[model samples]
Target: MRVLIVDDSKAIFMMVSQMLEEKGHVGIWAEDGVKAVEYLQENSDVDVILLDWNMPNMNGPEFLEKNLTDSFTKTPIIMMTTENKPDYIKKALSLGAVEYIMKPFTNDILFNKFELVDEIA
Candidate 1:
């Protein structure tokens, strides 16, 4: 699987990419939503997106609002954020995120979440 990782933190991206690599999935990262959008424009074959709520230039929700249309409507977007607020989670789901992953997560937690997305997809 090819996963798009959108986060501002280099550590987060590295951690997630390493985990995905261990799972035999390829990970492509973008520092923020703007770069993510640009990457998506060139690589629409990505299997899923791991999105961060807070980012510079373009946030997760704004990214969803801008790109979740036409061919991208049903693409799976999983929110990987430090924001634990129920309202925020609800808002992200309402905006088309398939699931939410809180920060400080373990590889097992991330793998389990990925399994869920795979099942649905």
Candidate 2:
């Protein structure tokens, strides 16, 4: 799968990209929501989005709200963040996030989440 990873942290991008590669998926990254939007505009083959909740310039929820329309609305977004509050998860889901994964995740956890998402998609 071609996955778009949107996060501000360079380390997060590196780690996630490595994990995705290990699982035989191509992972493209964006430092913030603005760049992510640019990438989306240029590429229409993204299968999933691994989004970080907190970022400079534009946050994950803001990005989803702004971009998840028309064709992009059907794209799956799995939020990767430190926010674990029920309300925060609720808000993300309400705003169109398909799944949520807490930060500092392991390879197995991420892989499992991706597998679960496959069923839903």
Candidate 3:
């Protein structure tokens, strides 16, 4: 699957990319939500998106609004953030997020989540 990691932190991008790669998933990088949107525009084949909560050009929620309203790309979004409040989770899901992963997640956890997601879908 073509997975896009949109985050300001390079370390997080590298970690997540490496984890997904280990699971035989191709990973793509975007520094912020703005670039992520452009990436989706150029590579509409992307199956999943991992978006961080905080970014420079546009935040996760802001980017999601555009994706929800824009006609181009409305692919599934998986939020990755440190925020663990129920309200935040509810908000992201309300905005059409398919899943939410807390910060500092390991490859094993991610793999398990993916497995469950696949089964549920």
What TM-score would each prediction reach against the true structure?
A: 0.91, 0.93, 0.92
Write down the worst ten-residue block by lDDT for model 1: 66-75
lDDT of 1: 0.87
Off-target runs (Cα >4 Å) in candidate 1 are: 69-73
Number of the candidate with higher lDDT, 1 or 2: 2
| Best candidate (score: lDDT) | 2
lDDT of each: 0.87, 0.88, 0.85
Regions of candidate 2 where Cα sits further than 4 Å from its true position: 68-73
Ranking by lDDT: 2, 1, 3
Q: Which ten-residue region of model 3 has the weakest summed lDDT?
A: 112-121
Clashing pairs in 1: none
| lDDT for position 67 in model 2 | 68
**Which ranges in model 3 have alpha carbons more than 4 Å from their true place?**
119-121
Q: lDDT tens digits, residues 1-121, model 2?
A: 8889999999999999998898788989899998988888778888999999999999998987886563444678999889799999998989888899999999999889888899998
Superposed Cα deviation of residue 4, candidate 1 (Å): 0.6
lDDT of 1 by residue, 1-121 (tens): 8888999999998988998899798988899988988887777778889999999999999988887563443568999888899999999988888899999899999889988998987
Give the lDDT of residue 110 in candidate 3: 78
TM-score attained by model 2: 0.93
